[model samples]
Target: MTINETLIEKKFSNDLTEAELLEFKKLYETDDAFKQEVDFLKNVQRVSETEDDALFRNQLATYETEISPKKVFLNSKWIKPFSAIAAIFIITISISLFMNKDINNDSLFSSYFEPSKNVSAPIVRSEKDEHLTNRAFIAYSEADYQQATSLFQKAFEQTGNSELLLYEGNALLAMDKVTEAIEVFKTHLTYSDALTNRTHWYLALAYVKSDQLDKAKQELTIYIDSEEKFKKTEAKSLLKKLK
Candidate 1:
């Protein structure tokens, strides 16, 4: 379509060179309308392209939210960190799983695991899409975890809000930043019981992603016993796999 859209597609597709990435960032920094257009495209492309991104994005907001420019700029603070997240790959393992009785954890994890898609319920405070909260929801719904995390954090900062903290954590987990996600969820748990069951289920999945099987099983046990029917079937299946 447009030159900006082409550049953004290249950036997300990991086809941009060092020089192009730098120049693109320059455009991103100076052009607000361009940024929003690019974000809207990203929302469309990411969701329509894969079940993985769509599932994760849905996990960000339990309800619908909108996007805007100022909030998008607040989110731009995280674009650099996303370079790291995008660079990640499951490195090819040379070890033999059957012969040596050892398998690559990455391969093992990939075989049966996907991030839990559960999301915190939307607390529709303020006017619809008024500020950081709605922007954060929009980012997450678009699978823009990098921006979503930043917006969620900024939202939390504005009000000392714990529910936004839950969103930040969920966004991180979706990004596969498991360790950081764990702490955020734990903090949210301490501050509020609003989404206790959802938190437990997601926390358990975080442990699974991080290879903390024992801890995951423990959390899953708590979730299962708590009668959180929302994910009981999925939880039982995952728990059985863990055992």
Candidate 2:
């Protein structure tokens, strides 16, 4: 399938032969525009999921209230208008309360809302790019996958850095978009300066998701040969899993 179609179908998680994986890596390296588009698509998915969750919660609340026997009495003609008026009043009060709460809660929430005062901010930070990367890392380390995805996407746009690409790939994987995640990991492999063993390890995991045993084994083999001690151990463990 064409790269665009593959991305749309989320087929990047599919098991690919070593040759296929390598071929895609080459394409990703050569096609800058494609990489940008894929990043954009991933970001869109992240935002859409957040919105969907909020909508689902609202729908669920509506369903629960509507289906209850208590709601039937409110539907009666005598009570309906009063109920409607009361509802409007309640909504108005809620909005006013929320606005005021922000002011009132300032002192109460101050400690919680305070930026990390003990942790010094980075000197020579790269503005939006660095900020997003830092946010993504914090979210990832905390296992906050959704926030990491959003921040990493912003990081990728601001810097197009390999580290952000790797984090973005990881975030996608955490969201179970194995194919898309594989594509992202493979894209990082195109960078001559990418951390070789780490890239290989992630790519191998992606291969495992697609059930491409041979390709996974091959990547693990390369990863194990790298100078990085920790990654070599990881590679060996992964190899055992493939076996």
Clash count for each candidate, listed in order shown:
0, 2
TM-scores for every candidate against the unseen true structure: 0.51, 0.44
Give the per-residue lDDT of model 2 (tens digit) for 148-203. 77887887788777666676677776676778878878887888553535767777
Query: In the order shown, what is each candidate's alpha-carbon RMSD?
Result: 24.8, 30.1
Global lDDT of model 2: 0.59
lDDT of 1: 0.66
lDDT for position 124 in model 2: 38
lDDT of 1 by residue, 1-243 (tens): 567766776776677989889888899889998788667656644434433343433433222224433333212222433322332211112233333333333444445444434254453445555677777777777788999899889888997767677678878877878899999888877875556666777787777667787998998898899956967887888889778
lDDT of each: 0.66, 0.59
Clashes of 2: 2
Q: Which residue pairs clash in candidate 2?
A: 12-179, 13-179
